[model samples]
Target chain A: MNLLEWLPFIVLIPLISSGIVACLPGRFWPWAFTLLAALASAVIAALVLPEAMGSELSYPFGNWQPPIGIEYRVDAANAFVALLVAGMAALALPWAKASVDQEIPERQGAFYALFLMALAGLLGITLSGDAFNIFVFLEISSLATYAIIAHGRDRRALLAAFRYLIMGTVGATFLLIGIAFLYMMTGTLNLADMAERLPEVSDTRAVRAGLAFIIVGLGLKLALLPLHLWLPNAYTYAPHFVTVFLAGTATKVALYVMLRFIFTVFSPDYSFVVLPLSSVLMVLAVAGMFAGSWVAMFQDNIKRMLAYSSVAQVGYMVLGVSLVSAIGLTAAFLHLFNHALMKTALFMAVGCLAYRAGSLKIQSLQGCGREMPWTMTAFALAGLSIIGVPTTAGFISKWYLILAAVEAQSWWLVGLIVITSMMAVYYIWRVIEAAWMTERPEGATRLKEAPLSLLIPTWVLVALNFYFGIDTRLTVGASSAAAEALLGVPTGGLP
Target chain B: MTDNGILRIIARFLIPFIMLFGLYIQFHGEYSPGGGFQAGIVVAAGWILFALIYGLKAGLEVIPEKAMYWLAAAGALIYALTGVASVLLGGRYLDFYAFEAFFNTPQAAQQFGIITVEFGVGLTVATVVMLIYTFFVRRKSEWDEVMRGSDAE
Candidate 1:
C-alpha cells in the first residue's frame, strides 16, 4: 500500500525482469533493458528508507510467524547494501559500455542479462532474512557469475571461473550444512528467532559445529587468509566490469552476513568461547594484510595486484571484527564501504588502461599519466586512498582501527596495520611512478582519454573518497551504530 | 535429425505441466521445504527435459539462445521488481506484509510476496538451464563437426 511495504518487490522486480529478458531476443538491446531494470530497482530500493533508517520490518511468509513460515527481514544494515548493489549496477550502465565493448562480444546482451540476474542475487543475499533464502541467492549469483566470467576473452578466464565454481560450491555446501545443523537444533529458519533460541542451548556441540561450519564457509567467501586462493585470479581474468562490481559489493555483503550470524543469530558470547575466535581471526587478518600486500608488490599486472590488495584490504575489515570492540567494528564496516569505493576507482583506472593499451601491465602503463591524464589521475587518487593517505576516505578507517588496536592494548597490531598499509603504499607508488615518471613508448603517446561515461563513474567514487574524508558523519556514524548493534550494546544513546 | 520421435512428442506434452508443478512448489514454499532455489532447479529440469528430447538445436529453435539469456535476467528482475513494488506499496525491503494488492489478507500478502519472488527465481533458473544447454550443445556440435572434417581429410 505504501513505499515501506513494497521492499520485497524491489528485489523481485530485477529478479523477474532478468528472467523475462533472458527469454527475450538476445539481439534485442540488452543494455537498455538491463539498465532500465537496474535503475528502476534502484529507485524502488531508495523508496524504502523507513525500513533502512528507521527500524526493522519482519514480513511473515504464509502469514505465519517465524518457526513456521519463512521470513524476509529488513533493517538498517542490509537495506543499505540493497541500495548499494542496485546503485552500482545502475551506475555501471555507462561504464559497462567501453569495458563490455572491449571484453564481451555481439552476444553482449546475454552477458548483460546474466549480469542483471547476478545483481538480483547479490541484492537478495543482502536483503533476505531467511537463512535458506541466502543460500538460494548465493547459488544464483555464483552460478551466474561463473558464466559471466567464462565469457571473458582469455582462456584463463574459463579456468578461473571453473576454479571459483569449485571453491564456491564447497563453500556453499558447507554453509548449507551449517544451516541444516542449526535447523536440526532449533527447528526454525528465522534469523531473529534463531538469535533468541541460540542463547538457550549455546553450549551444545551441534551449535558449535554449526558455528564452525558457518565461520569457515563464510571465511572462504570472504577470502579470509587460508581460504582466499580463488580471489586473485577470479578478479584478474574476469571481465573488467565484473572486477568493479564484485569488488564493490560482493565480499562486503558476505561480511555483513558473517557479522549478522555472529552477533545477532549465534550470540557472539557463546561462539567465541571455544576458539578464542577474536585472536584466531586477528592472526588471520594480520596474515592476510601482510601476505596480500607482499604478493601485490611482485605482480606485474596492475589488475592482479589490485586483486591481491583487495585480499589484504578484506583482512583489515576482518581484523576490525576480530577486535570485538565497537570502534573496531565501526572501522571495519566503514572501511568495507570506503574500500569498495577506493578499489572500484582503482580498478576502473586499470580497465581504462586495459581498453587503450590492451594490457594492464605495470610496465606498459609507464607514462600513462601523460597520455590518459584524467584516467591516471583518478588512479593516483584512488591509490592514495588505498594507501590510507590523510584526507582520503581510506585514512578514516585506518585511523579508527589504529585507535581500536591501541585501546585493546594490541599495540603490536597497530604496528602491523601501519606496516601493512605502508606495503600498500609501496606497491601503489610503484604503479604511480611507472604511470607518471617512466617514459611512454613512442606509439603509446597521443592516447585518448577514457570516454566521459567511464570517467564520470570513476570520478564519482574518487569524489566520494574526498567527500567522505572531509565529512565522516555518514560513514563513521552509521558504522558506529552498526558496530554497537553487532555488540548487542543497544546503541540508543551512542551518538 | 530424426523427425517427430514418439519420446519427443511425449516430452513436449508433459514439460509444461512439470513446469507448472515447479511453480506450485515455489508458491507452497512457506508451508513446505522447497521454495525459490529448489523450484528453480525443478523448472530448469523441465527445460532440460525439453532440450534433451528435442535436442539442443531444436530447443534453441524454440527458445532461442539470446532469448534464453534475457529470460534469465527477466526472472531475477521479476524477483527484484516484485520486492521494489512491495517497497513502493509501503513494505520494508523484502517485507511482504503490505502487499494487499496481490493478497487480500495480511497472511495472504506475505504468501503472495514470497511466491512472487519464487516464480522469479524459477524463471531465472529455467532460462539459465536452457542457455547453458544451448551453449554446451553448440560447442559440442562445433567440435564434432571439426573432428569429422579433419578425419575425412
Candidate 2:
C-alpha cells in the first residue's frame, strides 16, 4: 500500500508505541520510544500531504465501509491539521526530555507514555470521520492530560488538574449529548452522512438543539471567551512541556472540530442565517478579544499572562469564523497554524527561563535577558510575531482577516481587530522590557544559558514563524484550499 | 484473625469457584454477553474478598505489586501485538481475516483472534483494578514510611 493507504498508521503508530513504551525497561525507554514514534508520525504526515491536498482519503477499519464501521478521513483541512499536530509532537519530544527531567523526576516512563497517547488522541480527533469517534479520542487525550498536568511539581498543580478535569468532563459530556442528538435525528454517526441528512430536518427542534449543544460544548473545550475559566490555571500549573504542547495543539484541534461541524456537517445558512450563530459568535469574539487582552495586561505570572493571551488569540480565529466568508474562513485556518507556531515557541522559551530562574513570575525575568541572550532573543522574536509585526507569521493571518472584514465593509470590526492587537503588543512588551532593559538584582549570581535541548526546539519554531511569514505559499495555499473546500466552492481560489 | 470459623471456611471454599467462574466468562465472552471487562472485574472482586477476610497481607503475597505492574503492561502489549500480527500477515491492522491463512477455515481463525484479544483485555483490566486497590487500601501510609526509612538509612 502507498503512503495514503497507511494514513491510519499515523494515529495507530503512536498509540501502539505508547503501550509498548509503558512496558519497556529502563527509565529512558519512554522518551526514546516516544521520540521515535513522533518522528515516524511526522514523516507519515508529510508524505500524506500531496495526496491530502488533491482530494480526501477515507479508510475503513478492517475493510468495513463507513456509516457502519469506523472510518478515517483526511481532507485538506484535517490533513493539514493532522500534519501540524504530528509535527508539533515531534518537535516537543526533545524539549520534553530535558524539561520533564527537571519538572517531574519520577515516572518518566509513564509521562512519556501519556505524552504519546495524547499525541495519538489529537491525531485521532483530526482524522476521524465519525462524530462519536471524535469524542472517544477527545476523552483519551483528556484523561492523559489531566494526569500529566497533576504531575507538575507545584502543589497547586493537583488542584488545577482537578478543576480542569471537572470542566473538561462537563464539556465532553455536553459534546456527547449533542452527538447523540445528531445521531438520533439522522440515524447515522458519520459526519459526511449527517451533513447530507441534517438539511432535510433543519427546521426540527432536535436538530436545532443539537447544534446549540455542540457549539456550547466546543466553546468550553476551545476556551472561547466567557467559558475559558479552566484554561489559565491548567496552562499555568501544568509542567512547562505539557503547557507547550497543549497550548500549541489542544485548542487548535477543538477549533478545527468546531469549524468542521459549522461548515461541513451543517449548512452555513442554517448556522449563520437561521440560528443567528454568526451574530452570537461575532459578539463573543469581540468580547473575548477585549476581555482576554485586558486581563492579560495585568498578570504577574508570565505563564498565566500567556494563558490569558491565548483566550484573546482564540477570539481572532472565532471572529474570522463569524464572518462566514471564504477569505474569513481562510484567515481563521491560517491563524490556527500561525498561532500554534508562535505560542509553542513562546511557552518553550518561558520553560527555558523557568528552568534557569526557578520561577515563572515576570519579576523574576528581570535582567535575565543578558544572561540568557539566545533564549531571550527567541522570546523577543516570538513576541513580535504575537504582536502581528511585519515579516512574521502572525501578520499574514491578521492581514487576511482585515481584508475580509473590509470586504464585508465592517470597519468597526477592522478597528476592533487592530485595537485588540495593540493590547497584544503591550502585554508581550512587558516581558520584553523585563528581559532586555531591566538590571539584574543587586549581588545576584549570574545564571547560565538554557540547555541546547530546549533552546534548539525554541529556535526551530522561531525560524518557522519567520520563514512561513516570508513565504506564504505553503500556509496560505493550504488554508485557502481548505477554506474553499469548507465553503463548498471549487478548490481553485486565491482567497 | 477471623472470629467466625464458618465464615473463613466458607470463604476458602468459595474463592476457587469464583476464579473458575471468571475464567469461564473470559473464554466464553465472544459468543456471549460477559467478556473480558466483566470477567476481569469478577476475578478482581474475588481477590478483594479474600483480602477482606484473610487480610491484605495474604492478598499481596498471592499477587505482588511488582507482578501487578507487569500484568498490566503485558495485557496491553498482547492486545497491541495482535494488531501488529494482523498487519504482518498481509492485512490491515486489527484485521483478523488475515489469520485465515494459518487456520483451516476463516471462522476458526476469527474465533482464535477474538478469544486472544479478549484474553489480553481481561489480563489488563484485572491487573489495573488490583493495582488501584493496592494503592488505595494496602499501601496507604506504609509505602511512604518505607521510603522515608530508606532515605534516612
Candidate 3:
C-alpha cells in the first residue's frame, strides 16, 4: 500500500526466490533467477529510498507492536545503504555469470542460491530494528558466506572458510552476549526501546560491560587491525565473484550496525565520551591505516593486495567515526559508499583478468593492458579513485575526511590521511606498471578481451566512480542527512 | 540363519509409528510446546533409521535426490509465500490479519496462518534433515570403493 510496506519484500523476495531457484532445473536458471531477484530488490529499494530518508519506516511483523515483536526500521543511513547494496548485487550478477562459470566445476545452481541467501541476509541486517534479530540475520549471512567461500575450487578455500567460521562464530557469540546484557538491563530487545531505557541505567557496570562486549564483537567483524588476520586469506582464496560481493558489502553492513548501535541504541555521550573510546579508536585506526597499506605493497597476489587495501580503507572510515562530529560521521558514510564502488570495480576488473589469464598474481597481469584494453583501462580508472586522484570518488571521500579532521583541529590526522593516499598511489602503480609497462611474454599466445557480460558491469561502476566524484549531490545529501541524524545537530561539539 | 531378521523386523515395526508420532506432534503443536521443528526432526529420524537398516540405494529409491531438493525448497517457499501473500492482501508483511476477509474472524485467520506456516516449516525441516543424512551416508560407499581399489591393487 505504501513504500514502507515494500521493505519486507526487499528481503523476502530474494530469500524466497533463492529456494525456488535451487529447485529449478538447468545450469543457467540460477544465474537468471539471481539477476531477476537482484533487479527486483534494487527497484523496490530505489522506490523506498525517498521515504526512508524523510523519516524512520518501521514494520512490525504479524501485527504486533514494537518492544514486543520484531520490527524492520529504515532511516536515511540504512536506507541509503540498502540501495547501495541492492545496486551492487544487481551489477555484480552479470559479472558473476561469467566468473562462476569459469571458476566452478559443478553445483552452479547451489552457488547462486547461496549468493541470493547471502543477499537476503545482508538486506535483513540493514533493515532489522530488533537487537537480537540482528544476530539472527548476521548468522544467516555469515553461514551462507562460509559456504560460498568454500565453493572456491582452490583446496585452500576450505581452510579459509573454516577459519572464518571459527572467528565469525566467536564474534557472533560475543554479540549475542552483549544483546543479552542489554535486554537484561533494559527489559526489552527492541533498539528504540533499549535506547529509551538505557539512560536510566547507564552508570551500571553491566551496561558498560555490554557496551564493551558489543564494540569488541563488531570490531572483529569490521576486521580492525590485529583482529584482521582472517580477512586476507579468505578474500584471496574465495571465488572471484564471491570475493567481489563480500568485499563490497559484508564489512560495510557490519560498519552500519556499529554506527546504529553507537549512535542509536547507546547514546554517543555514553559510548564516546564516558568511555574515552575515541582515543582508543583513533590509535587503532591510525595503526590499521599504515599497517594495511604497508603490507599491501609487498603482496605478490593481486587479490591479496586488494584485500589488504580494504583494511586500509576501513581504517579511514573508522577514523572518521572516531571524530564524533556531524562532519566526521558524514565523511565516514561517504567513504563507505565511495569505497564500495571503487573496490567492486577493481575486483570485477581483476576477475576479468583472471578469466583470461588463469591466475591473480601481479606477474600474471604483465602486458594485460595491451590485450584486454577495456578491462585494464577500467582497472586503471578505478585505481585512480582508490588512490584519491583528483576528480574521482576516492578523492571526494578523502577531501571530506580531511575537512572533518580540520574541524576537529587534528592536523596530525589530516597528515596521516594524506600519507595513506600516497601509499595507495604506490601500490596501485604496481598493478598499472605490470599491466602497461611489461612487454607481453615472447612465447605467449594472444589473449582476447573479456566478454561483454563482464565488461559491462565493470565499466558501469567505473563510470559512476568519476560521475559521482564531480556531481556530489546524491552522495553528499544522503550522507549529510544521515550524519546530522546521528549527531543530533549540523555540527556536534561533543569532543 | 536369518541374520537380518531382527533388524528388518525391528525397522519395519518402528518406522511407521515413529513417522505417525512425528505427524501428531506437527499438528498438535498449537495446543502444546512442541512444533514443526521437533516434529520434523522426529520424522527425519524415522527415515534415517530405515536407511541405516537397509542401504543408501534403497533409501534413495524411497526419496530421490531431486525430490529431496524440491521438498526442501518447497517447504521454505510455503512459509515465506504465506507472508508474501499477506502483503499482497494489503496487510503488513507476514500479518495474518490480511486473511480476515477469507476467514470467519480475525482470530480464525490468525490460526489458519500460523498452522499453514508451521506446516511449511515442518516440511522444510524434515526434508533437509533427510537430505543431509542421505548425503553423509552415501559418502561411506565411495570411501569403501576407494579402499577396495587400494586392496585390489
Candidate 4:
C-alpha cells in the first residue's frame, strides 16, 4: 500500500480509539487502549514525516477532491507539529496512568476517552488543510480540554474550567466569524485555494475585518498578552497529566495556526507591510515577555508560575514571527519544538512532586531535592533548559532568536531578550532553591521518591532537552525547511 | 403533576404521535430539509413531555441513566464505524461508493450510507439531549448532597 493512504489514520486512530476506550470496562483497559492508540498515532506520524518533508501529502476525505471536500494535508511545517503533539501524548501517557489513578479515581474510562478525543482533535487541527476544518477540531479539542481541567483535585478546577469555557467559546465564535468573512470573500474553504483567490479581493474591507478578527481570536487561543487571562488558572488547576499535554501542544498548535494564516493563507506582505501588524505584534510580544516573567517571579504555586512563564515563551515565538524573515520564522518554529520539550519535562517533574507532596505550592517543594532526588534533578535539568542555559534545547532556540533579532537590526530587542533570559533565570532559581537548599518544614511527613513509572518518563524528556540541544541536525534542519516552506522560498542553507 | 389527570391524558395521547412524526422527519430527511438533528430534538421533546406528565421516576424506569450513556456512545461509534467500513472495503474513508456492488448501483449505496449515518446521528442527538435534561433536572439534589457531604468534612 502507498504510504500516503496512512495519513488519515494519524487522526482516525485516536478518534476511533476514544469511542472504544469509553465503551471498555474497567480502569486498566481504558488506559492500556489509550496508550496503544497514542503510540500508533506517533509511529504513523513519524513514518509520514520523511515523505511530508520531501513534498506535501494530501488525503481527501471520502475520495472527494480538494477545493470540494475536506483534506488532510501535511507538509514539513504541520508534519513536524503533528509529530510533536503525538509524540508528547505517547510519552506522557505512561506517566499518566499513575497520576490519574491518584487524582481521578472515578470514571477512568471517560477521562481516557476524552484524553484520546483531545489528542485526535489536536492532530486534526495540525493536519487539516481547510480553514473551517481547523475550527471544528479546535472546538473538539477545547471542549474536551475544559472537561479534563474540571477533573482536577481542587474545587477551583471547576471555576477554572468554566472560565476557560467562556473564553474559549468566544474565541471559537470569533474564529468562525472570521472564517465566514473569508468564505464570503474568496468563496472557498480550502486554505490553498483561498490563498490563490484572496489576492484579487485582498483590498476589500471585509477581508481586512476578517484578518483582524482572526488575529484577535487566535490571540485569545494562544494567550497572547492582553488576551492571556484564561491560561494561568486553567494550566494551574488542570489535572497534572492534562496540564502537561496541553501545555506542550495546545498553544503551540494555536501559534501554528496563526503562522499558517499570516504566512501561507494570507501573504506576509499583506499582513505585515499593508496592515502594520508587524509592529503591533512586536510591541505586544515584548510587553508580554516582561509582564509574564515579572508575574511568574511572584507566584507561590509552581504550576501557576510555569503557566506565566509560558506566556513569556509565547512572546519569544511571536517575536520571531514579527521579524517576517526566513531565519526569524525558523527561530519561531524551533522554539515551538524546543519549548514543547522543556515545558512538558518541567510539568512532568512537577507532576512527580505533586504525586509525592500532594500540593503544588513552593513551600511543598522544600527539601524535595533531598527526598526525591531523581525527580528534582530532572526538574533542575529541565529548569536549566528553560533558563536557556548552554548545551540545553532552550539555548539553541534563544540563540536563533537572538540571531534573528540581530539580523533584523533590532539591537534594543536583543537587549530585551537578554534581560528576559535573566528574568527566567531568577524565577527558575527560586524553585531550585526551594527544592534543593531550604530545609524540610517542621512536622512535614518524610517524602519518598516518586515511583519509577513517573520518573522514567520525566527523565526521558529531560534527556531529550540535552540531546536536541547538542544535535542540531533534526531540529535545525526540519525547522529551517519548514521556515522555507512557510515563506514559499526555494531551499537555502541556514543563515 | 400526577394529580393533573387532564394534562396526563393529553400528554399520553400526544406522545406516540410526536415520536412517529420524529421518525417521519428522519426518514424523509434524505428528500427534504429536516434531518437527524431536528428529528432527534422532536423525539426528545416527546420523552421530556412524558417525564413532565408522569414524573421523572417513571421516565427513568423507561430509559435508565446508564442506557442513555451507552446509547450516546454507541450512536457516535456507529457513525464512525460506517466510515471505517468504507475504508476497509478499499475505498477512501467514508466513500459510500465502496458499497456499490452490494447495493447494485452507486446512487443507492450513497443513499444507504447517508441514511445509516443519519440514523446514528439521530440516536446520539436524541440520547444526548435527554442526558443533558437529566443532568440539569438532577442538579439541585446532587448539589444538596454535595453540600451535606462537605458539612461532614
| Among all candidates shown, the one with the greatest TM-score | 4
**Local distance difference test, each candidate:** 0.80, 0.89, 0.88, 0.92
Worst 10 residues of 1 chain A by lDDT: A19-28
Residue-wise C-alpha lDDT for candidate 1, range A1-495, written one tens digit per residue: 655446665666676666555545444467778878989888887777434564676665444566576666777667666776787777666687778876776777558767877888888888777788889988888888888888877789999999999999999899999999998998788788888787777778888889889888888889989899999999999999988888887788788888888878876776565557888888899999999999999999898999999999999999999988777888888888788879888888888888787888887778888889999999999999998888999999899889889878998998999999889989999988997888987676456788887899888888888898889987777677667666767555432
> In model 1 chain B, where is the ten-residue run with the lowest total lDDT?
B86-95
TM-score between predicted and true chain B, model 3: 0.92
Badly placed stretches (over 4 Å) of model 1 are A23-28, A43-51, A61-63, A442-446, A491-495, B1-134, B148-153
How many pairs of residues collide in each model?
81, 0, 0, 0
DockQ for each numbered candidate: 0.30, 0.58, 0.81, 0.80
Q: How would you encode candidate 2's per-residue C-alpha lDDT over A1-495 as one tens digit per residue? A: 667557888998998888777767656777888999999998898888778885889987665678887889888898888899999999888888889888887778778888888889999999999999999999989899998899888899999999989998999999999998999989999999899988888799998899889988889889997889999999999999999999999999999999899989998888888989999999999999999999999999999999999999999999999999888999999999999999999999999998888887888778989999999999999999999998999999999999889989999999999999999999999988998899988887687999999999999999999998999999998898778767778645655
Native contact fraction, candidates in order: 0.42, 0.48, 0.84, 0.77
Can you tell me which runs of candidate 2 are displaced by over 4 Å?
A: B1-5, B143-153
* Residues B44-100, model 4: lDDT tens digits: 899988988887778778899889888889888888999999988998888889888
By lDDT, who's the top model here? 4
Q: What is the TM-score of chain A in candidate 3?
A: 0.98
The alpha-carbon RMSD over the true interface for every model, in angstroms, is 5.5, 1.6, 0.9, 0.8
Off by over 4 Å in 3: A490-495, B1-3, B147-153
- Judging by DockQ against the true structure, name the best candidate: 3
